[model samples]
Target: MATTASSAVTASLTSVTLEVADPDAAHRFYSAFGVDTRIHLRASETPSSGFRGFALALTVSGPATVDAFVDAAVAAGATVLKPAAKSMWGYGGVVQAPDGTIWKVATSAKKDNGPATREIDETVLLLGVADVKATKEFYVGQGLTVARSFGGKYTEFAAGPSSPVKLALYKHRGLAKDLGVAADGSGSHRIALGGTGSAFTDPDGFVWEA
Candidate 1:
């Protein structure tokens, strides 16, 4: 008798691609900002304005690391949307990259346990969708497992061992408020997700590919 080998059937986010007007410049900025290894870049003149309906986040170990990232980003030409500070949950700040991508550097630790380092614990892609419940269902159909969910307000997907980025969902207006930006946005999302399945677009128009 012959037996067939089987593998776990699951969808995971393998990569993230950002479409920018100038790949070279974007490359420079990301490299200097110390996250070039986390994202891929492509050249495009896609007209985008306002919030872009998404934000990339870096989870670090402590407040010092968060400050280091924010300072590096600003030095690399990113504009400070919110200066680093301590909040009830943690210390964090928001910055807009030179290519117009919103980035949030944060940590749940209120203070540093050790010396500051450029190490990033996790990279998260937060999509601000119209309906969290519907979008969560869409990703579920694509085989993504829910790691966490909060009613119709937010949802988080479990990342596979090899996945480079984690995925999450948030209400459009709530996310905009958290990022201190306007909720209204139009044109391309300027971002893409690489998955382990066939290419498709999500309910909120987030493009994903195998």
Candidate 2:
């Protein structure tokens, strides 16, 4: 659905809405990060119903930063889904956020290379949508320029070079394969965002918080 307003829109996401049983508690737990978040309380949802389809990726420049960041996250109620260490991709680890969302914190230092600086870098929101083409079109229709895209597999968008975070989309099964999870994601999408786009849900159920 295109409109004159859609064409004129200049959008950037401000939050990821999550459906939770307790908004206050989830808010308290997620408040540790600077990223603004929204919570929706729904009693009908199963324990696994919310936020099972995506991962938040945080990147730093080296190992020590990754460890410290992850350590702090764990201390702030996040649980280690995967221990921090050097992986083929880089130095990083996985943690389950308080709202059941998964987070992957890593350094740019790849296992094949040597050391990089210890400075923390960027935090990116990665969404796993059921239909990449449709999802990409939805955001594009809302006036967010895609930074990069790989056929129908992935897409990234951010505000120029200064924004510390970026939004991305990927094919649902492809993302799940990397996380070693089932691809058939369901239940209350439990997430939302505010930006240029009209309110809508991608094929897999991730909702736009606006």
After best superposition, candidate 2 residue 209: deviation in angstroms?
4.0
| C-alpha local distance difference test of each model | 0.91, 0.66
Residue 52 displacement in candidate 1 (angstroms): 0.5
In angstroms, the error of model 1 at 186 is 0.7
**lDDT value for model 1:** 0.91
TM-score attained by model 2: 0.74
lDDT of 1 by residue, 1-210 (tens): 212213453888899999999999999999989999999999989888888999999999999999899999999999999899999989999999999999999999997899999999999999999999899889888988788788788888888888778999999999999999989989999998999888999988899978
Which parts of model 2 are misplaced by more than 4 Å?
Answer: 1-9, 31-51, 110-120, 160-164
My TM-score estimates for the predictions, one after another, are: 0.95, 0.74
| Model 2: how far residue 186 lies from native, Å | 2.1
Once model 1 is optimally superposed onto the true structure by TM-score, how far is the C-alpha of residue 210 displaced, in angstroms? 2.0
Winning candidate number (TM-score): 1
